[model samples]
Target: MKRLAISLSALALCAAASAQVTITEPWVRGTVPQQKASGLFMRIDAEQHVRLLGGSSPVAGVVEVHEMAMQGEVMKMRALSHGLEIAKGHSLVLKPGGYHVMLMELKQQLKAGDRVSVTLTFEDVASKQRFTREVQAPVTALGGAQPAPAAHHRH
Candidate 1:
């Protein structure tokens, strides 16, 4: 009976760990034929403070977390040197023209209605517990959420 109690306790702990965060609306843009790069977006609701370290997928040779920002007249997109922090009781949104996952050197093209698997690594800031959540993202077309176009045509 003591062993049974211990086993159940372990199972409960594992469930709690996985339940602290909820990832939703995971989607990737459909790439044109021969395109080697793409972006992935999603929403993460964290019950506890956590940092999104990185992501990986077999479809892409390299995966990175990136942030897009307007630097003066230039639209610059760069990888986040530090992981993105999702505060406790808050939601972090990864969308176009903002923070997102970049998938480069694709092994195959993503088509509309298709799905790809990605693993997002995260770490709890306090206890340092780390875990990964596997997300299946559907391929979607460009939506109205894109940022406004640059007002000037630079030569």
Candidate 2:
């Protein structure tokens, strides 16, 4: 009985430590069944200021952090080589028509209402700390009812 209690306590501690980064309201906008690309939106809350280095998902071969900006009246999207900065006690939001995670070379077709898992990596700028958080998000079709907007940040 004592051994069992100790094991359970250790498991709980590990779970908590693994989830240093909190992900909320994760959802993927709906796209054509065969669409080659799709975007993921979510909010990240960290206890301390950190940088989001990158992400990965089993559904896609490559996942990149991208930003959309208007340059010369032309909307351009570009990959951010430097990880995104997340200020302490603040939140970073990824949403449509703005900053988002681009999933490229999708390995599987994402259907509306389907749930997919994404892993996000974070690094603390001050301590050079690193951690990862996983979130399961449902895919909603484009033009579907939109979810409440998350906090936004620009590069």
Specify the highest-TM-score model's number: 1
TM-scores, one per candidate: 0.81, 0.79
Worst 10 residues of 2 by lDDT: 146-155
RMSD of each: 7.8, 5.8
Q: Per-residue alpha-carbon lDDT of model 2 for 34-76, expressed as tens digits?
A: 7778888888877677788778999988888889999998999
Off by over 4 Å in 2: 1-20, 145-155
| For model 1, the run of ten residues with the poorest summed lDDT | 146-155
Please provide, for model 1 over 66-112, each residue's C-alpha lDDT reduced to its tens digit, 9 standing for 90 to 100: 99999999989999877889999999889988999999999998876
Model 1 spans with C-alpha error above 4 angstroms: 1-14, 142-155
- Rate residue 23 of model 2 by lDDT: 75
In TM-score terms, candidate 2 sits at 0.79
* Clash tally for model 1: 0
